[model samples]
Target: MEEYFSAVRKMEQTVMFPSLLQGVSLGDLANTLDSSSNEKDLYESYTLLKSIKTMVEDGLVPLNQTFPVATQMKEQEIKEEEDLESLFYYHVSSLYRILTRLTRRAKAVTSKYDEIMGQMNQNEKRLSF
Candidate 1:
């Protein structure tokens, strides 16, 4: 999980996110144009991934009523065996699942960004030559 998160963060820092986004504008990443283009969705997920992690790190869960992830997680956890250890395991498993999904999503967004960057590079090379 950390591996995936680290990999995605590295990619985002190095290439996935550029100041100019090459030829892709901020608008391109903000709104869905068509089904063939998913830049908007990817960027949304990218921001969401970061936002969720930051919220967790900042102690926004359990007390912060505005955190949707916490609310959703609470609703999803199994409501069986109201013992301390059982509840502990349930929370642990739920957190593990959420982290895994978020990290994998970050990696997928990175992959899509890499593909976009590659295409931009190819276009640049063609124009330069």
Candidate 2:
């Protein structure tokens, strides 16, 4: 369980840092657009900048709610050895709920990131205009 918590914490930190870095990148991109000399380049940069913002926001959600993965194994063992159906029902079920919530959140973030990437690609296609 300790290892599980450690892994979850590490993942949380990993997720947080990338989101922060992405925000920094988006800011830098915005600054670049602000000083850009060409109008078309500025518009494309602005579009890319918006997409980056969306990605950063989407990445933050999972970082906010991390769950320890080993909790279920522990509960399962306890349930088998002690014949404690209620404890298993509560702890294991809670872990499942948390896992499902996190999974759904990650999927949503991924979808948002994909959408932003698609928008970025579309903007890239139009950059020559």
Per-residue accuracy of model 2 over 18-127 as CA lDDT, tens digit each: 33223323233342223332323222323333353455446644633544655566566665767677766977888666444433333333334445567767999999
The TM-score, computed over Cα atoms with residue i paired to residue i, of candidate 2 is 0.39
TM per candidate comes to 0.64, 0.39
Encode model 1's per-residue lDDT on 1-129: one tens digit a residue.
566468556656755364333344334433322234334455566666677666665764456555676567666554544676988886789888767766666666566577787888999999999
Candidate 1 regions off by >4 Å? 4-8, 15-40, 62-82
lDDT of 1 at 72: 71
Kindly report which residue stretches of model 2 are placed more than 4 angstroms away from their true locations once superposed.
1-83
The global C-alpha lDDT for each of the candidates, from Candidate 1 onward, is 0.61, 0.44
